[model samples]
Target chain A: MSTTRLARTGGPRPAAAAGRGRSLWRTVRASGWSYAYLAPFVVLTAAFVVYPIFASLGYTFYDWDGIGEPSDFVGLANFKQVATDGYFWRALGNSALYTLVLVPVQLVLALVLALVLNNPRLRGSTFYRALYFLPAITSIAIVGIVLKLMLANFGDAVSKPFLKLGLTDEPLQFLGSPHLSMWTVIAIGIWNTLGYNMIYFLAGLQTIPKDQYEAAQIDGAGRFAQFVHVTIPGLRNVGLVIVFLAIVGSLQVFDLVMVLTGGGPFYSSDVITTYIYREAFGQVGTGVAVEPHIGLASAASFLFGLLLLVVTSGQMLAIRRLRARKEGK
Target chain B: MTELKGARARRGLTHLVLLAIGFAYVYPFLWAVGSSLKTKIDFLDGGLGLLPSRPVWENYAQAWREASFGTYFVNTLVISVTTVAFTLLFTAMAGYALARHTFPGKKIILGVILATYLLPHGYTIVPIYDLINSLGLLNTLTSVILAQVGGGLVFGTFMFMAYFSTLPRELEEAARVDGAGFNTLFFRVMLPVSKPMMATLGLFTFISSWNNFFLPLVFTLGRPELRTVGVGLYAFTNQTTTDWTLLCAGAVISLAPIVVVFVVAQRYIVEAIAGAVKA
Candidate 1:
């Protein structure tokens, strides 16, 4: 029935290549096991991960509820609305405010902890290391829900202390107050991630070579001076990677935000991810759930994803250039 | 003598700070463990204490039965193990090929694999799921395992390829010269040499597959029978007025395997990560 069989019986089916047919089959037979190993990865990735990007991007250009063939081309309409939309700006503002406050404070806290733990003479070093790294392996959904409960359960833990110290007259509802939700989200991230980042810092610390630290000490360098002159400079690339990663991770912040705030306390904590999810996955609230806005959500997703990719890639390039210039590469 | 005195003062301050941080870090874990033993009233009784007066170790068993997590645990283990197994097989073979073989189009294929690593996992979710569903794999362990394999391979391939690039090719060539062929050289010779790297990759992949949340969440349809520990653990806390004891119990059971892995494999982890960094 097939050309290959016909060719075998009738002298190459047209005299093109009688010998090549068997060679190709033979080649396949030999590497069949390799293909067996590779099939799962390739099939899953090509179908699930790679295809979604193209599909979602295509969805951005069409108005389809994902249940019908009556798709309408709403060219760039979602993008236009998202750009001009007040809610979009507010969402961006919340993320920016969160990051601005969170990153520096978290970094300082982690760095201080790292410097303290870098003491070679410390007892229970391994136990302390494991403790610090604990939160990192927990699932985001669990962390999100647990942190929310803790905040709610012990509102006085944060609010009463701040208020008792005269920081504010009113107790802040960290997750309930629109003003405080984003900061609390940031705090959750820092708690979960500090150890992972600290490990990165520790690795960078190793590259400094203990001899340099000894030399600095011999030259009458204070601990602060050694850190300022040697440790900080030594950590530049790792810092760059950490900063870039944190920025990217911040942009992709969705699961925790969804579980904890649901982009709420008045839609004040909504970012692109939660906004996209709500649009695409029917936000249920206040006695009614809306239908999916597949087209609009897809458009917004593309814009957000593209912006994130560009920012992260740019940061990576800048870091490489800085590294090269310093290394005289 | 002045230097010694200053060093002593700084060391004392460092020790104090380290001790404080160590307390903060360890306290939450202790609280989680302690609270899991408390009754609902006991949990509501106080903010945080070292241990409960009445330890209800049965909460772990009760939570297990309530969620029917016994079934889900087996499902997760199967999917995770399958994923790690496949990822190691394919990524290593492909990595070995890319790193050692001077084949045509090798650079282009390797480049493509590297590029895929930069794209966020979320980007491909729709297409991949659609394909799986089209193939009648929706809600199947195979589908989840497949997704994990893909996600893990990108990193696994990169790490292994980087590792193989550092290995000596002469040994392999000598085997090849002896008419050993590709399969024999790869399996009989090259693989035996990279046992440590493979073990490291296995540990990394196993932990990642165990901790995977998003893939299971998206694919498993919240079917209590199909969820991984990462997704299933949220059942306790997704509701308002979460029972802290039950929640902590679930968290403990969920994290146990990973903690054990971390504790047992610390030496290999440190070595692998340290090697990865320097390379």
Candidate 2:
């Protein structure tokens, strides 16, 4: 009887082990289809998105001019060159300045407009929303092109009255003078993207329950008091997000700046992006031939990316701290 | 009575301010359209005046011929359409896989994909440009489309994955119970049901692809004939002495399709942004 029991137990044990093995194989076979679905995205992303990043990182350590293989491994020399470059710092500062001036002004304007448009009693609000949102949809490059042409051609015409009225002796060079170029770009940038933020703020407004405003009204809050107490608090989360997006977006300003200023008049309005473009592709429209520096440009790009990462993380940390404090209170 | 009068006046003042700002906001495009229809002299001398003394309709034809915008338009359409197709196909398949199936290495794959979102897109162009050059695909529409698709996959896949996750489990169970295979379940069952998500993503992809300048510019640097409208227009402006009217006409041509797309799909576009932000 004992011998019989041992035989039976051993028999089931091998069968159970085999069954488990079969099930695992079944799972892997089932997952074969899943991997097939993921293949194209994986392959393309690996080749295009993920690979280029590492490739660029590799390029940053060399001094190659984008032709043939990068042979000269300079070992952080490119990074040092970028760090010491005056033009690099200028470009970085200009980008920071653009974000600083743009975020507050754009957000405040967008919020004010959103409040006006969000009023349920407002007539033709949809029309006004579409009207304001027009520039945001249009291509920034095309917008820059048209504006550049208009300012170049009719700038004198528009400024003629000012000139005649002795507002200024010379015709205002909207894009020519270095002092006015960055401001001009910023003004156009605001106009170009104001509608997007307005829409965002409007969306935020939609999330604020109608009863809260009514509650505030019943508590004897006037219009300004209600805005200060209710709307501001309601918009806090979305406001942080909008601020973050605007800052990041402004820092990456490329197409518009390229079309509008080409970072011209001795790189006065040059953002980091334009600076990188100049290094990678040479001076595009200035009839000047400068050798393309793939290594240097890649180094600059990685450095700028690092800086952006630091800034964004700092912003996130501050936001978290603020939220924690509020919750703690 | 005084309160009612004051309220009416306040409403009127608000309308006035909005109207004025709205006009200033749209005045650039209006000015461009008006200038496109103006004679060279009218355009030069018109000064802030929107209406041309006499509309010159031939400027469009002239700009079309001179800048070869016809070729550029066709190129842009082909590139944009192809990019959207590949993007939708790859992202949808991948998103479905990620959402529905529990597979080995899924977490690692997801981690790798998410890690890419942190990389700033600005500096990577050098390597991408070089990659295209080495592949011997430089100055071709294929290169442009490939780069656009590759660069855009992360966002599309993420969006699609989120969308697919929200779908009911019974969808797959029903398909499987009906003896439907994996491909049939995805293509016939799941993809058809995800029409709204597709539309939202497809429209955005189309708009961005149409307006894209940098990739097209860099990839097609050696071949101007293959340049898209955005790059072509930039090139047009770079001529030493530009015809302002023709430039304006070119701008209008580039802006027309997008403006129409926006006007027609504004509701979807707005809703998509709101939805994305909420998510």
C-alpha lDDT of all candidate models, in order = 0.71, 0.87
Q: List the residue pairs that clash in candidate 1.
A: A47-B127, A47-B128, A48-B128, A49-B124, A52-B127
Q: Give the DockQ (2 decimals) of all models.
A: 0.28, 0.51
In the range A1-329, model 2's lDDT, one tens digit per residue, is 22223222423322466588775566567678788989989988998888877788898888988778899999999999999999999999999999999989999999999999998888999889999999998888888998988888778876788899998999999899898899899989988999889989999999999999899999999999999999999888888878888988999999989999999777999999999999989988779888888889999999887877776777678789878989999
Q: DockQ winner among the candidates?
A: 2
Error of 2 at B171 (Å): 2.0
Stretches of candidate 1 above 4 Å error? A1-43, A68-70, A169-171, A214-222, A284-288, A327-329, B1-13, B119-122, B177-179, B240-242, B270-279
lDDT of 1 by residue, A108-159 (tens): 7777666666667866666666677767755566656656766777777658
DockQ of 2: 0.51
Candidate 2 local lDDT, B106-145, one digit each (tens): 7888998878865555468988888888889998999999
Each model's fraction of native contacts:
0.26, 0.59
TM-score of chain B of each: 0.89, 0.97
Clashing pairs in 2: none
